[model samples]
Target: MACPLKNPLFFLLFMFLPFPTTAQTYRNISLGSSFNALQDNNSSLLSPSGEFAFGFREIAKDGFLLAIWFDKIPNQTIVWSANGDNLVPKGSKVELTIDGEFMLNGKRIRNTEFVGIGVAYASMLDTGNFVLANRNSSIVWESFSYPTDTILPSQTLNQNGILYARYTATNYSTGRFLLSLQPDGNLVLATTRFPQITPNYVYWSVKNPNIGFRFIFNESGFMYVTSKNESLLSTISSNTVSMQDFYQRATLEYDGVFRHYVYPKSTSSSAQRWPKDWSTSSSPFVPPNICTSFMESTGGGACGLNSFCTIEDQGPTCQCPNGYSFIDPEDERRGCKQNFAPQSCGETSKEETDVFQFQELNNANCWGGDYALFEGVPED
Candidate 1:
C-alpha cells in the first residue's frame, strides 16, 4: 500500500487546508475625512519598524496628550507631544477633516496652508514624525516641526524652534525651562516665571560668532549646529559607536538639564537601563553644579526663591540660610522664612533695643552676588 503522505491527492488536500493566522504585531491607523477616536482599547499608528507609536497617551488622571513614544520600552518614552499645555480628557479624539483641518476634542488643533486642498491621510513615520499629508502625499504638518521637550535624531531645531521642558517627569504640562535657538545665532537655555515683569533668566548659552542658525541631532548621537550654507559651525557628540544602533532622545529636563538618553533596541528588563550619553555641560566646571550659580528669586533657579543650592552626591540639594526655616517643610525648594521677629524701625530706648548680628554659613554662596555695601552709621 502506498503511503498516504506520498499520495498526490493527499498532498493536494493538505496544501488546501486552512490554518490560523497570527495577529499583526503592530497597528496602522489610516485617517481620511472622519474622526479617529484613539481610546485605550482601540487605535494607534505604529512606525514601520514597530519602534515608535503615535496616539493619545495618558499623562494625568483622565488627561491625555497626543504624543509619539517608544512603543517597546518598559515605560513609554515620549519624544514629542502635540498639546503639552492643553491636555484633553481621556476619551478625546483627533479628527482630520477632508478640508485638511485637524481637530482635537472637537476644537481645531492645527491650521495648515493646505486647508481646503484635501488631506488624504495621516501616518507615523519610522523616524518618529507624525504627519498629515495631502492627496498627492505632500506633507502638510508634522510633529517634528513642533517639538515638546525631546528632540529625536535627524530633527532640526531652527531659530524659531523651542524645546519647552515639562513640569515634571510625570506631569506633561509646560515647565519653567526653555531651550531656544536665538535669532543672533546663539542657542540659549532660559528659565522664566513671569514673562510680563521679568526677562528670561538665561543660565546656559552657546554664544559663538560662528554659531549656526539651526541645530540638528544626527542618528549617530551627534548634535551639530549648521549655517544656512550647511557648514557645520559646532558639533556635540557622545563618541560611542553602540549608541548609533539604539533609539536616542535629547531632552531639556524640567530641572534645566539638557541630557541625551539612549534606549537599547533589544533589552531585557533585567538589563534595561537608560544610559545618559551626553549633556549640555553646566558652568562652574562641575556636573550639574550650575544650579548653585543661578540667582534664586521669586521666579528662577532649581531650588526656588530664597533657597541656596548645594551639590550632593545624589544631585543638587536646596537648603535655607541660617536663622530661617523652610516655608514648606515638605518642599525645601519653596525656600525659607524668618523665624524671629525683625527689629523695630523706631526703637529708641537703649534697654529695649534690638541688636542684629550676622552668622556665617560654611560652604555656602548666595545665589546672586552678596552685596554688603553699607554707609557707616553709629547709633547711641
Candidate 2:
C-alpha cells in the first residue's frame, strides 16, 4: 500500500524547484568538489551553453591533458591547456578543497595569481572562461589571465602576453613559433630556437608611433591593439563574426599561422555556405606566404632540414626530395635523410665526379644553403 501525503503546501513547494535552461547544461562546482581522470561522469565541467568543457582529456593511452575544449563540436577542438609540456598520468585529480584551497593532485597550479580573501565556488562560463569566485561573488582567479595557444571572445592580453605554438599538429609540446605582445609595445611573430625559449627572428610585426598597452578581442570578433587609455592604436583583425550564431576562436596554430575560425551553431547560414567543419573567417593569413617568408638562416627552413615546403590551400606541406626521405614519416617536421649511400671522397676522383649528376629541382632553391660557384660549365 502506498501512503500518499498530498497536501496544499506540498503542491505549492514544487513551483520553485530549479530547472535547467534549454541550452545551459552545466552547474556550479561548490567548494570541496572534484573530478578525476578516466571517469567520464565526474571528469569534465561543461560551460553553461554546453559548448565548452574543462576537464581531463586523454591525450594518450595512459596520459591525460588537463585542458579546455569545444564540447559540442565533432572534432573536440582543444583551445587552452594546462599541462601541454608535461602530461599527467591517469588518476590525477583536481579539487577546490573544503578549506577554499584549489589544487591539482594536491599541488597548487603554477603561475596562478590569486586575488580576494576566500574562494567559495567555481564556474565555467558560456564565454569560455573558467573562474573561481569568493564568498562575495568576486572573481579570485580566472583562466583568461593564463591562456595557452587560443583566445576566445572578450579576452584581453596585457603587455608581455604571449602565445606559444605547439610542436606538431599532433604533438602538443612547445614548438618553433610564438606570438609575443612585447613589453615595449610591439606585437611580433617570431620563430624560436628549437628546444629553447630564445627568440631567433621576427618575421612579422606591428610598427606604431604610440605605444601599445594591451591586446583585446571583443565579442564582435574584432581584434585590436590599444593604447594605455584603451584607445585603438592599430587593428590586427577587423573581421566580424557574430557571437550569437557562431562559436569563435583565434589561435596561433602549430604551423606558425595566427588565424581566426568560426563554427556555426546550426546548419549553413542563408547569407553564405558554411562548411560543417570549422572554417577561416574574413581575416587574411597573418604572414601571407609561409614558404616564402620563413627563410631564416639561423634555423631550419619553413618546414625542416633537407625538406621542400609547398603552399597548399589549407596550409604549408613538406616533402622530401628524390634522394632524401623523411626521417620520421609520423612527424614530417623531423627533417629528412639520404636514402642512397654517399660516394667515398677518396675513391671518387675529379673525373669520377662526372658520374654523379645534380638533380635539378624546378623553381626550387635552398635558402641559406652553402654553395660553390663554378666559372664555366660544359653542357653534357
Candidate 3:
C-alpha cells in the first residue's frame, strides 16, 4: 500500500541518477598521476609492442638498478641504467609524481623538471626510450639522452658523453674503462687505476680531427660522427645494412674494449642466437694488442700488481712471479704476494750466510716500477 507518487515519477528519477565509478587500474604500466611501486610484481612498464620493459633490475641479492632492456631476451639485455654506480635496495621504486617530478627510491632525480607544464605520463617506447612526457605528448626527459654503458641505434651521444664500464660481468659498480667523446672531436677509450694518482692512458682513439660534435648509431648498425648541420663526418663501423632487422648495441666492455653486438629478432634452436658480436675495434688500430698495450702503473701488465701478463692463444693470461703466490687463487686480477721472507730480520750471521740465489722471471713487473737496481754493495 505504497503511495503512487513514490512508486511512479520518483522511482523513475532515482533510477536515472548517476552512480560513482572507480578509476581503471593498470598492470605493468603507470599513468601520469600514479606511481609504480617495486614491491608490486607487475611494477615494470612494458613498451606498446611488448619488446622492451623499464623497471628495477636486480644486479645482486639485494642490489637493484633501474634499467631499460629488451623484454623478450632470455637474460634481459640491459641497454640503459639510471643509477649504475649507486644501486638501490630491492624494494625501491621509481615514480613520476603528479607535479612532474621523477623520483627514484624516494629521491627526486635532478634536471627532470618539465618546463611550463607538468608530466602527463612516463612511457616505455618500443624503441627502448623511456620518456617523461606532457599531456600534449611533448617529451620532457628520456633515457636516450643520458646513456650509461651502452648506446642503442638512433641515439645521439654528444661530445661530452661518457660510457663507463661495469666492475665485472656480475658487478654493476663503475669500472676502470671509459669510452668518452672528447671536446676535441676525438672518440677515445681510456683506463685508470686511481684517478688522483694515475693518469688516464688512451687505449684507442679515432684520429679524425674534423669529426662532428655528436656520434650517432644508426639502425643499420653503422656508427657515424655527425657535423652540427647533421652532415656525416666519419664512419666508426664498417657494418653495412645487413643488420637492419636486428637490434644492435655498442658497449664499452669492462675489459677495456669497444665492441658492437647484435641481437636477432627471432630465436630458434637452429638460429645463431641473440647477442652475437657484430664487430670489434681490433688491435693495431686500437690497442695494438690487449695484453701489452695496457701497462699497469703498479704492475707489469694489464693483470694487476705483482703479476706477470702473457699472451696466449685464447687471450691474455696472468701468473705469479717467482717466490710469490696469488693473493686470491680464484681471481688472478687480485695479483700476487710473497710466499716466503728472504731472511729473518734479526738472525745470526750464520743464518744470514745461508745461500739465497736469485730466481729470475721473464716479463716480471712490480708496483712503483721494476725492482730497484743497485750499483754499490750494501752499507751496514
The estimated TM-scores of all candidates read 0.74, 0.85, 0.73
lDDT of each: 0.61, 0.72, 0.61
The list of candidate 3 runs beyond 4 A from truth reads 1-42, 110-117, 193-199, 241-245, 267-288, 295-301, 310-319, 322-334, 342-380
Worst 10 residues of 3 by lDDT: 6-15
Q: Cα miss at 59, model 2 (Å)? A: 1.8
Clashes of each: 0, 0, 1
Instruction: Name the lDDT of candidate 1.
Output: 0.61
Q: Per-residue lDDT tens digits of candidate 1, residues 319-368?
A: 67677777877545455677888665465655546466667655454434
Q: Per-residue lDDT tens digits of candidate 3, residues 92-156? A: 76666556677786676645644425666666787788877777788878888877778887787
Candidate number achieving the greatest lDDT relative to the actual structure: 2
On residues 213-300, what C-alpha lDDT tens digit does candidate 2 reach at each position? 8889899889899989878888988877777777888888887888888878765463246766777745555776566666555345
C-alpha RMSD (angstroms) for model 3 = 19.0
Which stretches of model 1 miss by more than 4 angstroms?
Answer: 1-29, 33-43, 110-116, 193-199, 241-244, 267-288, 293-300, 321-360, 367-380
Output the worst ten-in-a-row residue range by lDDT, candidate 1: 6-15
